[model samples]
Target: MAEHAGAQKGDVICFGHTHKPWHREVEGIHFVNTGSVGRPKDGDWRAGYVILEMSGDQPRVEFVRVEYDLQQVMEAIRQSELPDDFAEYLATGGIPRPVESAADAE
Candidate 1:
């Protein structure tokens, strides 16, 4: 995530962490979030991506979410040693709501 400090409308910034799809322009700066490829938080539960088209000095952005065999993905998670919570995230978009801490579970 290149902050660039002072980004303009024509200047775009790309980043992903919240796993939520988003595209907005504020203070003449373009902000884009690609979400996730395997697990998304946008409640669509599909692979998400962004397409940026630069026409001259201006730029066009598009967000895309692709659906696939989620069953296979869950299977892979089950086979792996990853935490069960991860599977839950994949099953229900990104991280499960009401995030419970380890102490809370205890």
Candidate 2:
């Protein structure tokens, strides 16, 4: 991923599309993924985030998780036209399977 992103040595890259928090250093490049705060898909389920501190020439990364009112979000979803599976996904942190099509089954 770094290769495609043209990341170089000593570069710090931060991204959060996957909703799963992670950090790593590759060939002097630092990569940080600051997971989702509301719709997390990382199974542990609490809101996930990250803190990056730069002291002098060194960088420090900290992952943070916080508790939120899941029931309130679920209730809102229940009242909406969206499918119930959305609420379930928020509770379990597991993505709902895509609905299979008859043509694709072959």
Top candidate when judged by lDDT against the true structure: 2
**Candidate 2 Cα errors over 4 Å, as ranges:** 2-10, 95-106
Candidate 2's residue-wise lDDT over 1-106, tens digit each?
Answer: 6583464545688888988889887766788999898888778667778999998766899999998888998889999998987888888876665788999898
Task: Give the per-residue lDDT of model 1 (tens digit) for 4-102.
Answer: 526443477788888887887666667888778876776777787889898876678888878888888888888899886777788788645786999
Clashing residue pairs, candidate 1?
8-28, 9-28
Q: Give candidate 2's total backbone clashes.
A: 0
Candidate 2, residue 53: how far the Cα is off, in Å: 0.7
Query: How does model 1 score by TM-score?
Result: 0.72
Q: What is the C-alpha RMSD of each candidate to the true structure, in Å?
A: 4.9, 5.0
Looking at model 1, report the run of 10 residues with the lowest lDDT sum.
1-10
Model 2 poorest 10 in a row by lDDT: 1-10
